[model samples]
Target: MRVFRIAKKQYLEDLSGEGSRLFGGRWNKKGMPMLYFSDSLSTSLLEVLVHLDFKHLTKDFGYIEIDIPDNLIDTKLKLKDLDDNWRDNPPKSITTNLGTAFLKANKKLALKVPCAILPMASNILINPKHKDFTKLKVIKVADLDIDSRLIVDTK
Candidate 1:
């Protein structure tokens, strides 16, 4: 299966998941290493754009295309399986704890979960420490030319 991630140009080559570990995210708590990837490029872009402020938007963004074997994705989560407040901003412990448990269990390389930004779409959470993680390949990395209009202040 193919997955995509949008990040700053310099960080595109770093798959260590260190950034997410240090800052945490919706699914993982601080100190837990997890790589977030979207099933589609648009979803990846949207995931990043939503968290970015117009003033911080820059042209130094890039996209990564990774190939993960289908078998490596052992767990799949649906919206119904999550807490009623799973999509809450600031992230709830219910979701973070669930993800933390998944990482601690260390049974799979990737966990497929619903994207809060677009629930119909999905995101793949990668456990960098997993042994099978080495099997994932970075097939492509290139500049992501985001439209200028997206950063314009309409107000």
Candidate 2:
């Protein structure tokens, strides 16, 4: 299977997930840094839409697709299925071995290839620390890869 990731121009070629790791995100507050991917181009757009500042969006942005290894262990869950307790009481941090048991499990699975193939809205968290993560490859989007005319402001 394949997954897509939409990002700012600077990160278009980045596979290290360094930015995510350094800054941390909703899933990993302590900066574990997971390479996030979406199931499709449209989904990838929606994933980053929430983070866009229209003023700054004028800058270059692009999408890339990656092939998922068959051997990797990827866990998927519906957003609604996530436990309420998890929402109310999130982990102190998703650093080595800390956080809700389920989330921790997901983290462990992610650490394997360091990837969790979740729904596009949820994000495919990739752990760069995993040994096999290097196997993942990406195809950068070219001019013909996307139709700029089709894009529209969600607002």
Q: What lDDT does the true structure give each of the candidates? A: 0.90, 0.54
Off by over 4 Å in 2: 76-81, 85-122, 143-155
**Residue 125 C-alpha lDDT in model 1:** 94
CA lDDT for candidate 2: 0.54
Q: Candidate 1: where is the Cα deviation over 4 Å?
A: 153-155
Q: Which lDDT value does model 2 have at 4?
A: 79
RMSD in order of candidates: 1.7, 5.7
**Deviation in angstroms for 153 in model 2?**
9.8
- Candidate 2 Cα deviation (angstroms), residue 128: 1.2
**26-135 per-residue lDDT for model 2 (tens digits):** 55645555666765676666556656654444447767787767456455445454443433323223322332232345434342212122232344556666666767
- The ten-residue window of minimal lDDT in model 1 covers 146-155
Q: Model 2, 135: alpha-carbon shift in Å?
A: 1.7
